[model samples]
Structure formats: C-alpha cells, structure tokens
Target: MRQDTLWVHREFRQLWAGQTVSQFGTYVGQTVLPLLAATSLGPRPSRWGS
Candidate 1:
C-alpha cells in the first residue's frame, strides 16, 4: 500500500500559502479600514448613537 500526504505535495503547499496570505490581507483590511476611515473623518458627537 502506498501512502500519500498533502504535506508532501508541492502544489498543495503553494495553494495553502496563497490562501494564508489572502486571509491575512483580508483580516488586516477589515481591522485597519475602519480605523483609517474614522481617523480621516474625525469625531462627531451627534453620530455617536446613530
């Protein structure tokens, strides 16, 4: 019987790495975009509840 593991596959490794980078970029954008927008727009007391 021959056993094969995904860790031994080059294509799988590349795919996994690309997915990881994409996820990290998405996470960074999600976290940073809001902060960037808030900083650029400044604070308005009237919009606090709405």
Candidate 2:
C-alpha cells in the first residue's frame, strides 16, 4: 500500500476512536446527570401558578 493510503487509514482510525470515546462519555453524562439531579433535588411542588 502507498504511504499516503496508510496515513489516511491511520487518521481515520484515530478519528473513529475519538468519536467513539466522545459518544460514550456523552451517554454516561446524560445518564448520570438526571440521576444526580433527582437525588439532590428530590420532589418539588407544582408551579401551575396559584
């Protein structure tokens, strides 16, 4: 294979790895933040304007 082709492949692999990790972190944060908010804030009264 040509050197240029090899470089392209390496760059693609790096990009794929980065995107995968970023997506995983996003999913973890999405899952964790709501749980944290619920635990910390507990229930609140309705705000339907008195």
Clashing pairs in 2: none
lDDT of 2 by residue, 1-50 (tens): 57666446977889889999999999879998899989999988978957
Q: What is each predicted model's overall lDDT from 0 to 1? A: 0.87, 0.86
Kindly provide the TM-score of model 2 when superposed on the true structure, using C-alpha atoms.
Answer: 0.51
Which stretches of model 1 miss by more than 4 angstroms?
1-3, 36-50
User: Given candidate 1, what's the lDDT at residue 49?
Assistant: 79
lDDT by residue for model 1 over 11-46, one digit each (tens)?
Answer: 988999999999999988999888899999998788
